[model samples]
Target: MREYSYFVYLMASRWNGTPYCGVTSDLLRRVVEHREGAAEGFTAKYGVSRLVWFEQQSDINQAVLR
Candidate 1:
């Protein structure tokens, strides 16, 4: 089995707030970027900065399809 570093994650504004689904290799950095509003996008606009769920995949294809 080859090593991989892909992740599918979910971010939310609050426990019941709107959820945002995404994929990234660096989960920490991505979350931080979202929190800091590094880019003006969906997560930033909807305040979906809280990590709610995550799962790793073997590759980008798998991660994206997930």
Candidate 2:
């Protein structure tokens, strides 16, 4: 099994458009969920699904701080 650290990420509605900041352990899955509208919230409503930036961290605290 592959181990993954927490990730701080930014999702954009479009190029240079609205940006949504978030943290997750599974970036791929989380992004997919956002794209498919699987999780109800701001990202789903605003269609902020494109991944703009991401940073990996060792722990949740660091991910949150980033």
Candidate 3:
């Protein structure tokens, strides 16, 4: 079977600032989107663009559960 990886990530506006949690199969692309405010949503509105934390998972379900 082909191995797959997913990520549970946290982004913040600043140090101990507003936070956003998300799960994605493409962490880099997702982070870039947040950084660029490409999506019109909470992260864009709240300026949550700094990558604060992340965890890797073996499956989408595991990443979502995290």
Candidate 4:
């Protein structure tokens, strides 16, 4: 069987500033999108693009639940 990885991540506008939570299999791409304001939502509106923290998960379910 093939193995897969997922991530649960936190993004912030600035230190002790607004925060955003998300899950993705492509952490780099997702963070880049947020930084470039490529999506229309809370993160873009509030500039929550800095990757403050992240945790890896063995499965998509675990990442999402986290």
Candidate 5:
């Protein structure tokens, strides 16, 4: 049996400001990718790269809901 962690994360430009919501299986890698602008889309366009908040879920569906 393999254990997997799903994360619902919020990224912001600065403290208490515009936030971006996302979910990923690898939170650290995903965050790093966003910071590097490797993620093609809104995050890359808007430059949302700072991690502000995150939540972990055992299932993908639960993480998506979060």
Candidate 6:
């Protein structure tokens, strides 16, 4: 079986601006997508693209609970 890792991340539009929280397996790719506005959603609308914080988890449950 393949090993799986998860992440909890925080994104921001600008310093002292709006904040966004997310979880993903590929943090780098996800952040890039947000910056490029790949999806027409909350992140794109508010321009929440900067990766300000992140944490990795070995278990999905652990990631979500915190």
Q: Estimate each model's TM-score.
A: 0.88, 0.88, 0.93, 0.93, 0.91, 0.93
User: Per-residue CA lDDT of candidate 3, range 1-66, in tens?
Assistant: 899999999999999899899999899999999989997979988999999999999989988988
RMSD of each: 1.9, 2.2, 0.8, 0.8, 1.0, 0.8
Per-residue error for 14 in candidate 2, Å, reads: 0.7
Q: Kindly report which residue stretches of model 2 are placed more than 4 angstroms away from their true locations once superposed.
A: 1-4
Misplaced by over 4 Å in model 3 are none
Worst 10 residues of 4 by lDDT: 39-48
Tell me the lDDT of model 1 at 21. 93
Preferred candidate (lDDT higher): 4 or 6: 4
Among all windows of 10 consecutive residues in model 3, the one with the lowest summed lDDT is 39-48
* Clash tally, candidates in order: 0, 0, 0, 0, 0, 0
TM-score of 1: 0.88
The TM-score of predicted model 4 comes to: 0.93
CA shift of 52, model 2, Å: 0.3
lDDT of 2 by residue, 1-66 (tens): 666699999989899877999999999999998889898888878888899989999889989988
Candidate 4 C-alpha lDDT tens digits along 1-66: 999989999999999999999999899999999999998989989999899999999999989888
* Best candidate (score: lDDT): 4
Q: Model 1 misses residue 6 by how many Å?
A: 0.4
Stretches > 4 Å off in candidate 4: none
Evaluate model 6: give its TM-score.
0.93
lDDT, residue 24, model 3: 90
Give the per-residue lDDT of model 5 (tens digit) for 1-66: 998999999998777766899999999999999899998988887889999889999999999987
lDDT for model 6 comes to 0.92
Name the candidate, 2 or 3, with the larger lDDT value.
Answer: 3
The residue pairs found clashing in candidate 1 are: none
